[model samples]
Target: MASHSLSAVRKRRRRRAKTLLVMVGLLLLTGAGGYLALLNLEPSEAVMRERCTAVVGTETYDLNPDQASNAALIAGVALRRGLPPRAASIAIATAIQESGLRNLDYGDDAGPDSRGLFQQRPSQGWGTQAQVMDPIYAANAFYDGLLKVPGYTNMPITEAAQAVQISAFPEAYADHEPEARAFASALTGYSAASLDCMLRSAESPGDPSQVAAAAAAVFGNQSVVVNESTVTLQAVDRAGWATAQWAVANAKQLNLTSVSFGGLQWDRVGGWTSAETEPGTVTLNVAGAVVE
Candidate 1:
């Protein structure tokens, strides 16, 4: 009778152990399944990129090719000239109000004294007709005067512009602040590469090489190299590409070099190459060759 009871007890312990092992295995399987599901799921807004065009006074301006390109230029200029985001926003707003991103040859009657993108007065030492008409030069000069204003960032856009221009109608500048703020938000790196431009006309001639060159002028040299079906970037900062062209133009100030795009695998050697073999692990590459 004792032997039989001991046998029964051993049988019960064995059953319990088996049950516990099965439960642990099931839990581990569930955890792994959940992890795999999360890995495969696509995030919302993954396809969205930045837009470069802005709306001003009920008019939609297509900036993708030219007007859009100016945002980077202006941002780069402002940063290089040591102006803050507030100043950049104010300048962009002033440009929107004055020229609508178009460098005009003529000014309205109210702007006879006005010229160039910001409509500076020649009499006020802003610049000569030829000099004021130059966008880069005009931008630099505007920033020079803007940097002199005390507490400009704390002031309203209208007040800030008034301090710079002292115009007869201070309220006019106020109306353009929203658009300026939006442009400034993009320029100041608040949003990551959210400001993009779509080519309005199919005939619009945009050279990626030229764009890249122009950007490199301010930002620095960036290259995409492929080796054995792998792409590699050297000394490039991917985040900086948001303002790549701007950085190229202000290269002297930013001292930036290299940006990569469109996915080449990167490794620790400051080297990026295409995956030579199937990824042993699953991978995701977002816009501009970035792996998330």
Candidate 2:
């Protein structure tokens, strides 16, 4: 009787052990399946590539890559200045005329007093030599004075710039307006992605990531990501879901990630990650600072 009882106890233990092993295997399989689903959830690369191509072909001026980059810089500066798309267009057109969007180290004799991207004169109250050289500051100053002029927006590009710049060669800005308008139209939408550089160069002082964060603060928790060489931002609605289907849809132009909705609030969870630890899974929380 004692031997039979012992045999039954051993059989129960073996069954429990087998059951536990099966459960663990099932759990691991489920976890792996979930991860694969997440990976597959990312937007199609081919689609993104096509969209990027369209943006480059349509929005950019016929100038070479250097000129396109310069145009983007000017647009970014104008956007930072809180200028409307029209105002940015006018500014770019003026720069195209003044320096062909190239930041010339030397000023032409026609405007020896002219300098920097906009060619504002230091002798004029535009600013000290240092201030005018800084594109953001100079552009903001120009827009500030430009906005104060009566009917500046309604006036021609030359008139608008001359109202602020008081340039002797007022008509020089007129020819550049069409190119500027083309740039503005391409960059002002929600679906409009980041402007690409024909030539890669050193990073600018005004990084687009910082700009996107500022825009998000005013606009709500929009998704910002660095894709290829461009910084993309997607606009989200009150629920934080992406409102546009693609990057070329809205007027507040920025690159964007594929839309995600109904997931755990990613912002609260923190930024994305590829870790396997608990609490390290992809969540919306802001990324924590790393130690040096």
Candidate 3:
């Protein structure tokens, strides 16, 4: 009887070991499969980030897509209205102070009625809340007030901005002068090849109507052309670069793959290239974009 019991015990231990081995094998296989799945996923399947930069001389300014886009519009509007580079700098500084270059519809307890990029108070004749929310309108309104300050272009940025903004924190605008200057120089075409954006993923493609409207909203009527596969803009030399760079600044959002003018072209993977192209018109090629 003792011998028989020993044999049975040995058999039971062998069976348990086999079962544990099978489980360990299964676990290893499962882990390997999961890791392989992760490796197979596309880069764009993950949330991708976009960035823009303005490099001028020895200075560089980096900003997110939204901030870059807004900065472009602010400076573009300044150019469209014949505002000097100094005016653009002061405007950009003021925007940096008020809303961090974003258009906001709310304000602090002191000026709860204040709104827009410049934090203009609707109750204080800055126009309707809706107008204040419009970046172009608000920028124009800011310029209107800014122009009223005598020789604002020649005044110190903080003092000029203070006269227009009348902020309780008047000196805050001074801190952003360097960054604002870099962005303004690039967007206003005073600094060539100074601005660019690295888009991490392909975005929704460009829309003809929307592109035209967006450009018109800032540059004012007929500065850009609406087309099925292209949006042409009337840019002369550096002005062309300003618009091309603006398209690049908006590439991620607009799914812009190509911005071409003169003998140069900017594409998604490779940046600017020397491509033979027509003069007098800057063509932005809109291929493989989501039209929405």
Candidate 4:
């Protein structure tokens, strides 16, 4: 009996150790810090935005600004790449399973090379240390692999993700499918005006150019106008929502005071209401910090 009990104890310890390794291994601070750079950006008396929500039919998913922001980027990248909506959902589901939509720089001890949002490994073909640590580059790399898989759209979300990421727990990705699909649909402009944000007022210097640049980074060929306090994205209703939601996601980071699209306005603490903008423009207003 003693011998059998000792063997069981050793087996449990090994399993625990493995779980620990994958669950919260070494913090790839460099990769994490760089990959999730946006998480640390935008310092101001800028009041943080409240929970951002994505509503699809009767289902709703509420996420923090950072998570919503990252999800927007993922969907934007997919659209920019000309991939289908299924691809975006798969990618979003994978990220949700791996990092809960927040870019992380943690990996298991046994395979400590993994880091960034996907928990990708440097040892694998993900990218160089610097590349994987950057969110744009990392997301692109993930797409690269995902695109290579044949019929990925037809596969189960978990199986599709497993094809791209040979994760130890291959089944984990399925659990996030519903939320991922909702977020992906909103961010992809498939479900127009389904994403909303509640912002708080703040006194922080803002940059229209920075928001423009970030939009361009995700959208690549999309046109954006940045002048003084206004950053406008000239798009039709659906695409405009994607741009408008992106602005809301990054509101705190950019000190955005208001985001408007198709005559729907979202200001700091103002929530969603009516606007009087042009018929085809999504505009964001950011104020210069009120110097005390």
| C-alpha local distance difference test of each model | 0.53, 0.51, 0.79, 0.80
Ranking by lDDT: 4, 3, 1, 2
Per-residue lDDT of model 2, residues 1-292, tens digit only: 9999999999999999999999999998788667545444222321222211113344544554445545555555455455677786788788787777766656764366677778877887778778877765666777788779887778888888777766668898888786677665444432232222221111122334644554453334545664333344543332122221111121113322222232322111112223332221111211222211
Give the per-residue lDDT of model 4 (tens digit) for 1-292. 9999999999999999998877664455455555445343333313444788888889988888788888888888888888888988998888888877777777753277777778788888788777777888888999999988998889999988999998889888888999889988888878766787665454467888887888889887566777988888888866788778777777867788888888788876636787788778888888775643
Q: What lDDT score is found at residue 216 in candidate 3?
A: 75
Model 1 misses residue 270 by how many Å?
31
List the pairs of residues colliding in candidate 4. Answer: 21-108, 205-289, 263-275
Better of 1 and 2 by TM-score: 1
The clash numbers for all candidates, in the given order, read: 23, 20, 2, 3
Model 1 lDDT tens row, 1-292: 9999999999999999999999999998787667545443223222333234444345443343344445556665676555677887888777766677556667654467677777777877888888878777778887878778888889888888777776777788888777666655555555333343421111122233344455445434445333322222233232343353232222222222222332333221123344443322112111122122
What's the best-to-worst order under TM-score?
Answer: 3, 4, 1, 2
Against the true structure, what is each candidate's TM-score?
Answer: 0.55, 0.50, 0.81, 0.79
Candidate 4, lDDT over the whole model: 0.80
Task: Give the worst 10-residue stretch by lDDT in candidate 2.
Answer: 243-252
